[model samples]
Target: MEFTVKNVEETMAIAYKLGKFANSGDIICLNGDLGTGKTHFVKGLAKGLEIKEHITSPTFNIVNEYDGRIKLYHFDVYRVNDPDEIEAIGFDEYIFGEGVTVIEWSNYIKELIPKEHISVEIIKIPNKNLNYRKIILNYFGEKYNYIKEIFI
Candidate 1:
């Protein structure tokens, strides 16, 4: 779906909607440019998941874990040079674990991601000061059909 968010609040609202439908073991791959409100969306997601802590980009830390209605594993691979680096950190544990994984810059480690996952792409339009994000929900396997249904 394509959405035009005028500011941060609208972006967060979108995240909240997605978060409400999220389930454990679900993987969300977020693709966007700098300052495109990916973190803003994450904050709303955390809130919707009933998490009370702060949500920030894990760019330096690589990953951040949060406890909510379910576990949330947030990964930022901006600093990762090789997909092997993700493996070194034992990414599979988070990716395949009983938690919701939201990955930033996930394109970097696409090979490691499971086929059945959700992909959200956020694109920033240069004009009009509006944050135009194109969120594409792609489900690869039968296990994710429910997710696709919810979004539809």
Candidate 2:
């Protein structure tokens, strides 16, 4: 579904809705340009999971773990130059682990992602005072088909 976010609050609301349906073993691929509020959406996800800690972009750290109602593995692959770099960090353990995983700049390691992952794409519109964004949702497996009912 397409979302016209007027500000960060709206974006977080969308993330909160999505978070309610997030489950273990779920992989979310976030695609967008820099300063597109990717991290803001992630903060909403953490809140939905009942996480109390602060959530930030995992740029230099690469990954950040949060303990919430369920485990959350946040990844930022913008600086990663090779797919092998993902493996070096043992991303599989988290991608396939017992928690929800959200990957920023996931397009960088597209080949490493599972086929059944959920894809969320955000686009910024130029010349708009409001932080306009187009959010696209694509489900790759039967497990996520129900998500369409909620957002689409």
Candidate 3:
């Protein structure tokens, strides 16, 4: 599904809607350029998950764990030199574990991603309002198909 948002709040609101239906073992891959509000999207997701703590990109640490109705494993692989760098941190455990996982800059480690996952791509609309963003969401397997219905 595709959506256009006029500003940051609308962008986060869309993500928040998805997060409300998030289930354990769900993998959400986020692809966007710098300043595209990927982290803001995550912040709204965390709120929807009932997480009370602040959310921030784990650029240096690689991943940040949050406690919520369902645990959230937020990963930032933007600075990763190799996909193995993620494996070294026990990537499988988190993605396969009983929690929701969101990976920022996921395109960097696409080969390592599971075939069944949800993908969100945020694009800046050139010549449009500076805060405008085009968000596209795609699901990979039957398990995630229902998510598409939410945006509809």
Native-to-model Cα distance after best TM-score fit, residue 9 in candidate 2, in Å:
0.3
Which stretches of candidate 3 lie above 4 Å from their native place?
none
Q: lDDT per residue, candidate 1, 1-152, as tens digits?
A: 56667778877887887788788898988888888878988898888788889998999999999999988899999899999988999899998999999999889888988888888777776777655655554656777677655545
Q: How well does each candidate superpose onto the true structure, as a TM-score?
A: 0.90, 0.96, 0.97
lDDT top scorer: 3
Model 2 lDDT tens row, 1-152: 67888788888999988887788888999999998889999998888888899999999999999998889999999999999999998999999999999999999999999999889888888765666877777889998987888786
Worst 10 residues of 3 by lDDT: 124-133
- What's the best-to-worst order under TM-score? 3, 2, 1
Q: Arrange candidates by lDDT, descending.
A: 3, 2, 1
Query: lDDT by residue for model 3 over 1-110, one digit each (tens)?
Result: 88998889998898888889999999999999999999999998998898999999999999999999999999999999999999999999999999999999999999
Cα deviation of 55, candidate 1, in Å: 0.3
Q: Please identify model 1 stretches exceeding 4 Å from their true place.
A: 148-152
Tell me, by TM-score, which candidate is best.
3
Model with the higher TM-score, candidate 1 or 3 = 3
Better of 1 and 2 by TM-score: 2
- Which of the predicted structures, 2 or 3, would earn the higher TM-score when compared with the native? 3
What TM-score should be assigned to candidate 1? 0.90
* Full-model lDDT for every candidate: 0.83, 0.89, 0.93
Write down the RMSD of all candidates, one decimal each: 1.7, 1.1, 1.0
